[model samples]
Target: MHRDIVYASPTAGGEQRDLRLDLQIPRTKGPKPLVVYITGGGFMTANKAGNLDERTYVAEQGYAVASIEYRTTTTGSTYKDGVADVKSAIRYLRAHSAELGIDTAKVAVWGQSAGGYLAAMAGATSGTDRFEQGDNLDQSSDVQAVVDQFGVHDLAKVADDFDPETKATYMAPGSFINAYVFGPNSARTVVTDHAANRAANPATYLNRSSAPVALLHGDNDHIISPSQSLILLDALTRKRVEGTRYVVKGADHGDLPFLPDPEAGRKWTTQKVMGTITRFLDRELRS
Candidate 1:
């Protein structure tokens, strides 16, 4: 594990932050395919190190994997800020690909939850200006594929579901995500601002040039609706973006462990889920 490699310095609130990422590179030589795993924090608090196990799993599959850092809403950052940091990380890896022994042309972004949204956006809005932040503008931030693990693609739609706690009886914000993705209370006003919502939405930027996408959402994922991935799928279908969605039957967010069932004692492992993602990446990257 190569630790604390600085990727960018972005100003958060009134202060500048030196963002970093850690990489796990396989022993096999020569321009390996790269996969950047963005950690899920609900756009509040989490670190790159949180996804170390997954990063190592990916590296063992013969891909260079990195656990990247991105600013959260608590730091006065928006979805754009997080995505920008994501793009910068990609560009940074590409810019120094030779030193890292990675194939810049075969990059992929994979993330869970909020990180998954960033991954989808990074792949969908490649040439467009969804976000063009940080350093290394010369190198393309385009990824060959996207593996979105239960991500929320449409913030506006989500906001409408639970802005005033109309959907549930309990404290919704703690369980159900309020649209704090772009800004505080932005989701509540999202219906009024079509342009802002469209700009912030990943589905709005899909085109034929968009990379192939793989969406993995658990059917029981209540935090971010399972339909969220389906909505993105609908846009991708219309735009003719090659994509696939694996709706897991029984699972929840951050349920990282593979829980074995009673009889077989081998039921709940995320191995099948991980395999689905890797298979898609291999086909997309042509690795």
Candidate 2:
């Protein structure tokens, strides 16, 4: 269902890693739309195989889907490096579109939790320079749409509110975002680096030409406050860009359905989420 490839040369660590992605192709002959799905681990630890069941479901819907890999901050990779790796992944995939049986031009980047931030970055910075890294520079790394599930929109805001006194920190030293901004090991001062976080936030990059984005967030997401989505919604509205969010009521971080019982008809189901996503993708990518 997938293959591995070294998309880049040796990193600053002098180790050339074999970054891999799972590519699932439908039986259709012609090139199909691509969904590059990213997994979330708060930027600390996670991989391409994190969300297998969901991605396979998308692939079954007549598309060439990919679950991509990116270096995490826990491995000494910076926030910029992670985004660059994602951009490079997109570029590498597009470069080999013919081989992968994918429609290079109709790609969507999708992710959950922290990966949601990466997916948003992929869509927001499409034509922008600076984030692109590694090989396959000729192919465009832009994605048509972004499907983010509970990713933070403003890092600085979160860091600012994350225990201003340092005693009540929302993010511990082991958190990947802290590693991203302050290296793998962090000082108390690193949590309050407002300026740095502001500079790298996705909200700072939004514009009229930014690709359409759809966010699915639990209203009661304890890990990432729903306020993050509100901030993004406000920014997107102000920018006059096409963006929307689905707030799953009474839902927490790991719960897909808002209700306590799956049999309850009052909450969202896996099929409901997929239907929303597939319909949005079709409206944005299909004719």
Residue 180 in model 2: lDDT: 73
Candidate 1 TM-score over all chains jointly = 0.87
Q: In candidate 2, how many Å is residue 215 off?
A: 0.7
lDDT of each structure? 0.76, 0.74
lDDT of 2 by residue, 1-287 (tens): 76666565427344666677778898877999988888877776657766566777788888788887788764577678778888888888889888877897878998777788888887888778758877888888878889888787786455433344542455566454566766666663334676776666787788765788999887666667777777887888887878998888776664222223433222434688778888888888886
User: For residues 133-186, what per-residue lDDT tens digits would candidate 1 score against the true structure?
Assistant: 778998888888999987878765653334366444222332223334446544
lDDT of 1 at 195: 76
> Which 10 residues in a row give candidate 1 its minimum summed lDDT?
257-266
